[model samples]
Target: MIIESNDERGSVNRSALRRLTGIDAASFAERHWGTTPKFTRSAELSGSFEDLMTVDAVDELISERGVRTPFVRMAKDGRLLEKNKFTGSGGFGAEITDQVDSAAVLSAFAAGNTLVLQGLHRLWPPLIAFTGELVRELGHPVQVNSYVTPAASQGFSPHYDVHDVFVVQIAGSKRWTIHSPVHRHPLNNQPWSDRRAAVERHADDSPELDIVLEPGDVLYLPRGWIHSAQALGETTVHLTIGVASFNDYDIAHHTLGALQEVEGLRAPLPAGWDPTDSEAVLPHVRRVLGDMRRALDELDRDPEALQRITERIASRYDELVRPEPVRPLRSVAQMGALRGQDSIRLRDGVIARVVRTPESAAVVLRDKTVSMPPQCADALELLLGGSPCRLDSLPGLDTDDAVVVGRRLVREGIAVMAGE
Candidate 1:
């Protein structure tokens, strides 16, 4: 779907999360985010998510999109059906064996299995753009998975996710029963399986909230909340927009991990002490704690340490959330056809930062860093400033040199021709 115009896209990007929750940023941060569940009706949200996905879209993805295993999965009665139940080999020249068989999917869905379309944020175009906006707004990596359940069926048993979620109901209705978390604010590594017994026990308790979600409805669920849903009366589809937030523990992990460079902290424990004996390990633990305390003090006073911590955080963010993709063929053509009079700007959704040193400036990207002479800093700054500018109008370079820089930027995927 054509989501919006450029101006509308910018406006939408800025308020994507707010639009979902029907609350301002401050209200969402103070009340709903990371603390409790929020249920908003169709009248509350800005609009429906029909543009993102639909029943027809689900059919297209299954029958025409060449979907493979893992991306297309089925579950019935809380147990995942084997891939062979819904997948088969493509015939003739295309001989991949794990592709989703539309006929099999039909049969399974008719038998009351829920169809799970995983990683739609990466596979679906509309979601790719929408998910990128959410990532930028939340500073938390976001993912989208759709659950299409047959009438009166459940996808999975009551469980919790390590990542927070905003459930956007796309079509039909699903009744959800949510209970308070047994273990709150779980980290990414802490899956519900770790506390399966507790989760199952909690499912029997009175629910904190029980509601039927219809089209245009949204439900925000913080990580570790025990919840389950069942389609009511008709086939149901909903997008699980998962947000993996960075936590204080992550900060400590990165900061302390950087302390490995300290010789004192890295020293081996006293030769042959028994690790199981508390008294034998106490002194070494005390010494290591003292060293860490001193190292932390040193790090607090060091700007370089702070910078490394920031970089590590950014690196992790980059690893989880991909920026908008560039059209390679179009970029190459634009590069070859470039001229001083052409307009160019940093590509939308490209995460870049310009860092300058005495002799050179570099644009840091996820994959590679593009370095340029210090003289190009001003030009790079203007180009990355969101607004398109005539190549010849760039500061610090002649018209021909500006063209050279423009082509280089396009070639490196840092910038694109204006209107692209």
Candidate 2:
């Protein structure tokens, strides 16, 4: 697999997405996104996920890490075990509320239960890196969960997730049975249980795909695709990378916030309105309808309003990122000692975007936005370029001005001293 960085766009190489899915990103978006299931066989898949997780890692997390209830769950015959079944008080007089009971979990596993480790991307560094790359490539929030099913055991019933998922088989093998979605492109609130009868009838009639996934295989199931898997002969461990797609509803939802600024949208309805009186409510309804149409047209024409919607969607990623811990003393001294030759780079997981206006340019970070004179636009570009650079190397700014700007960024935790 080839993974290259696109420095110009500050985006991951499109080929990386192709390599991961065995299909071009554009093609997948056009043909398969929220529409179908795809199974791609790859022997080289081990390199992509081998370091992300392992059975030993799962065992260690459950036994050592003070993992808790929701993070670690055990299920059998499609039913989840109660928290007390596999949780106990921690040592050192810790509270008994939610700590994992490793022994109980192990016992359950031995008795044919499937152990599920949720949010491994948050707990495991390797998975964090993997999921971060996916997030950058897909421009969507990515979450990871690990399913460790004992031999001849299954975790959940034949159901569908509202979000799309990439299942990577890391160890052992499992037989997967997939059926066409009963409700195509279902939203987050729509689960398979809502259409259980239709799903069951379709599943019974004929499954679209039934195959055994071995180590180094990948399966991509879009939202609403019904599927189930069971361990085959040996234990199975697979990573499910869930992608929360940004749908049209999300766009309208965010756009409505912008619409609220229009005066007509805020007018209250007439008091004591009767549902039976269409004539009484018709005027208000017609006015609001006209407002909605005008708002939509204005939003389509205004570039700034469109940009706001994009920023609103981008900000969701902020919650998934874990910022570097602030080192007050070291960071303070580093800011104070900025030299022309000192190298610096944006801190890991520090998201920054450049906003240009007629008067000035601003560098927007998660916690704050720094506005600077238009003269510093080139320097700001280099600083947010996802690469290390010395203060003296910025294109437009003089040495003194470069130092000033770099110091401000470093002081604000947006950038950090490289090689420190």
Candidate 3:
């Protein structure tokens, strides 16, 4: 769906973003996102289907990947890490080009091996960024991302996610059966990799809900829901857009992190308050909590800073984006990192560490874009999808931002940017 704003200024609108769900974002967050992601059969059809990327476009990606990186595994040990590959019950390494393009590539891979189809957010930047700009309008931080699994499946074991996800099916269909989360607001335990086993150890609730999704369908699975999916027929392709947001918990955590930087916040406790005295500590602690509350209450006070942070974070998603890797794979380690859909709130002109590139990307938050290097035709995909870039790491071009951005991108794994 083509969901741009109608203000005639070519800019995204917060109200419009809220309207996407037929409710304000705040109201949605209060009622959904955190509580439950409202599902709609026509979500993919409602707003902007016409201009979204196509199946043919995805076919080109499979072709292009051959020139860039190896088809690595996205799953391991019957468990799926965020970095592992996924495939169907048929197991991994299934060739599916017949269902995808000129020939079946899935047939070529091993039985249980499947590709990650990673970095769709960068691969199809316009669609994701458009969605992101809309989300930003509503004041919710959004992560632009993507995915396309063949018949085998780019697998992740039955598990939970770190953030909320809205998946739009672009090609074939898939089956989803989500068990209610053991803990909806799971206080992000251990690392994301460890969550799988921990979650598996928890007994699932009765009545797992199953969803059969076809092309053009969309599903919203709130974070922490224990869910599993597999390609339904032939091949399956889709886009999973994860939203990195500031929830009550997130705000408290971020505020805690911000305290290190916001000096007045770090001043020692009340002069007379004694840690040994509960009476004194009570009021002092109350005041401290109130101060923290007030600091976050001001998230929107300085609209410019709010907007800047939004832009900076939004720009982070593009840092590791590039469609095709700028360099061919010389080794498994050469594919530095895949980064994109990263997030930074660029408020107060406070520049955070995002992708540093020799070719400085003039990102337009208000307009939903980044200036790409001219020589890099795939630069847009790389920057927006989180693929590693060569201009910054390949030497001989521009400056240090390129190298820094490239290095950071390679480290993040948002996209595949292999180093020569």
Q: Give the candidate number with the greatest TM-score.
A: 1
Compared with the true structure, what per-residue lDDT tens digits does model 1 show for residues 1-420? 112222255443546776688776667877888998999998987776888999999999999999997788999988999999999988887689899999999999999999999999989998988887777677788999999999999999999999999999999999999999999999988899999999999999999999999999999999999999999999999999999888899989999889988987766777777999998889878978888898899999999889989888878777887767888987888789999889998776777789999989899887889999999999898877889989888998999999999989888878888876
lDDT sort, best first: 1, 2, 3
> Any residue pairs clashing in model 2, and if so which?
none
Q: For candidate 3, lDDT tens digit of each residue in 286-347? A: 88778777776675476764655555444544442322233334323443432232221112
Clashes of each: 0, 0, 72
1 or 3: which has the higher lDDT? 1
Error of 3 at 204 (Å): 4.7
Give lDDT: candidate 1, residue 221: 98
For model 1, state the Cα shift of residue 48 in Å: 1.7
Q: List the residue pairs that clash in candidate 1.
A: none
Error of 3 at 111 (Å): 3.9
lDDT tens string, model 2, 226-338? 89999999999998989887788877788887888888788877678896888888987897888899889989999998998888866766765555445789999889999
Worst 10 residues of 1 by lDDT: 1-10
Q: Which parts of model 1 are misplaced by more than 4 Å?
A: 1-14, 355-359
lDDT at position 291, candidate 1: 81
Ranking according to TM-score, highest score first: 1, 2, 3
Looking at model 3, report the run of 10 residues with the lowest lDDT sum. Answer: 342-351
lDDT of each: 0.88, 0.80, 0.50
